[model samples]
Target: MTPAIYSPDEIARRIALFERIRHPHKLLSEIHRALNIVRAEVNQSRADMVEFAKQNPGMTIKPSPLPLICVIGPSGTAKSHVIKTYYEDVCRTENWQVGRRAVFDFELSVDANKRQFHVDALTALKDPDPEKGNESVLRRRFGKLTDKLGTELGLCDEVQHFIASDTGKRTKSVIDAMKKTLNTGICALGLFGTQKAADIFDASEEFGQRAHIRFDLKGGNPDVADDRALFVAFLKTFKTEIEKMGILISTKTLEDAETIGCLFLQASGRLGLCQRIMKAALRVALESGATTLLPVHFAVAIDRGKLLFGIKENHFASHAEAFAD
Candidate 1:
């Protein structure tokens, strides 16, 4: 494809528009609802502690554990995207102190253990010397930082890494640390990962009991009528979104049933992958100086993304057939 000689400003403007467009998803609402519930519980817990402290000065207060919210999904389900979006929204809406952070999100490393977990948590909290302290000291620092930063939530991403083959001791240590944090009454916890994480949560009676709300992000089944309808509707809505961003899409091709089916197969019915493919398609269309985003642009994007994402097939590619009736 020949590159169009676009001004730097025009390219930036197009990129900004692409970044701003987001497909609305129902799972976002579920996450919001869970956050609201946890927030309410934390606020009440804080208020109760204040009242109790007033009544009994210099007395220790042990608060009950707050409920956890687990966001379980496969890769490309946008678990992190939705959580980060909510975190950004919170940062904007909340009038906290300048240096204080609201949400601390950290992904677990492959060599995840009790010590590394605390180190990662502290790092996410912006602790200046996360690796300098011992495990006990690091855990204490994490708790102190969470309290000081007025953190409302702590998100643990890719938690499956934390669960080792010897789940007895190692898993218990990490789980105990999380339970200790919850017991500290500093911040609510939210876990995000694939189905393996969900299985771990389910297997652990403590985590299972505490995590009453679990949001599962699953891909759509193309054979299912309702699922197919939802996927088609999402594409139509995206057409409107791109048009609003001043990118004209070929209406006839975009609205065609066969084209939509090809899109569904290429995207594997995952919204994250679908959006990524579309963004790549937009870039292809822009570079090619296409007046409108055509099916061929999407096909090229699918082929490119197939290699990038390790997708086995490119349904939109010319060699592939349309969805079978």
Candidate 2:
């Protein structure tokens, strides 16, 4: 799903809906009428820092290195989406327009390594010559380019692959290369990775040290009241949105609290997974020409994500009865 930016009134209406939904179909339509923005501390913090970095070019970079923010979490945790949304929004600001390529977001492939990392970085910066020189020369040129282009911030997603393949220190050198370029006191880094990303950072102590501010989006805990509430809200909004899209859901398992808790557990508290399964279920239902989505459709969706769902089959089996109701 696309990250959404909402108006103040939309935000207010969303909040009201969050408290209680009078009309599932209507609220779902509202959710689709445009994406809504939920103000979280992490989003605001990133926005503020980026804005400040753009406003005062030399102060922060000089006083200390452009701080790095590493968002570590599991797949479907919205790690990249959150930062990507923030970067895209900030880049559209007037301050960011003076230098078109000042901010960028790029994803790393599963096999990305040192050279490829630099190549990708250069490309993300929109550099004309990504392969012009050796590592050292390339880094220097990169620094000069950023200094020239007024580059400020960068986002690198799925950096775990780089860490996983750095057995011979090739990938570690990539960080060293990046540090050299970052000496220009511009272009702070935002790195997104999964739990394995821990090993990536630990592999390069210097890179780990540079990541001063770390934001982690752990899976929502159903045992925790706050987490439970958040999960419920997420589920309700999702259900409403689906209904609004014309898939009449006959399964109250999604609407009930206890049953939904089991679902959250089955999905391992990842909204992305939950959303994906729902979409898949809807697709199956629509394909079959069914007028409504049922528990069986959801079961197939859940089973498709078996290895990743992280739920016990017996426990999930118990929920099947409730899912049918």
Candidate 3:
């Protein structure tokens, strides 16, 4: 049920608040710096190409293979979100346009074959007829399109979909297509997926060498003091953001140590899961006409989210004092 107090505009504002509460993590900064390095390399390559063209008119110049980064992580760590956020920030700040489409992003289809993969890549490139070509034709078109679009970076999510659950020959074909794109020097590649996505590099040593910058996005560990502090700080920040949206959360709602422990346990130290549970609890509380957030709301949220969250035990309900002093 929609809360009576929440108009459509207010609901959108609250959602925006929740979505934008991204914690500034070290990985974010690292990826940003690494992409800057890639941009620099790409700029140098383009400069070299221009100089060569001026020196030798009417000559074909084949660009060298560019850099590649693989961002592998478990589910609920928001790897895709992190990569997309970086690109979005860069494009917005630099006022990038179609002629400067700094990044092209797309997700691989489940069990994606070479044909489907190229079609998806072309679709991301805004091809007028992504479906109008054979696999070989599509592959060449995608390469040309990337060059025409001035794509400096390519972000592919769910990369495991192509590499996993495929025959050896099929896997190599798709991986080769990916390699071909990079070899053309049209764009640097940032592949994001679950740990299984690492299989792409394992299958091809050359791919691994090109993608030397690998980041394993680890979730928090409640047992570690530093990690626990980080999660607690994130929860506090979440509380502040929600309050700014006029959610009327109690001071102790997410600030108390016991509550923090409950959340950590519920989410298995995944900040993404914590955010999900908190958002669900807010919906429950608002629909029930609660003026302030409470543990009971979270208990309900856990119960509702159990099927997907897979927590056998509802920590908020059964043992609220599990982390009490």
Candidate 3, 39-94: lDDT as tens digits: 77877887898999999999977887888888888887778777767866676688
lDDT of each: 0.76, 0.60, 0.77
Model 2 agreement with the true structure over 211-306: per-residue lDDT tens digits: 656666677776788777777877777667655543443544578666576668666777656666666555544444455556666665566556
lDDT of 3: 0.77
Could you tell which candidate, 2 or 3, scores higher by TM-score?
Answer: 3
**Model 1 regions lying over 4 Å from their true place:** 1-3, 7-13, 88-90, 164-169, 248-252, 319-325
Better of 2 and 3 by lDDT: 3
Question: Over the stretch 26-88, how does candidate 1's per-residue lDDT look in tens digits?
Answer: 667778777878878877887898899999999977987876888888877788787768766
Over the full model, what C-alpha lDDT does candidate 1 score relative to the true structure?
Answer: 0.76
Candidate 1 vs 3: which has more lDDT: 3
Candidate 1 clashing pairs, residues 3+ apart or interchain: none
Which pairs, if any, clash in model 2? none
Q: Quote the lDDT for 324 in model 1.
A: 16
Worst 10 contiguous positions by lDDT, candidate 2: 31-40
Residue 112 Cα positional deviation in candidate 3, in Å, after optimal superposition: 0.6
Ranking by TM-score: 3, 1, 2
Off by over 4 Å in 2: 1-64, 87-99, 144-149, 165-168, 245-253, 305-325
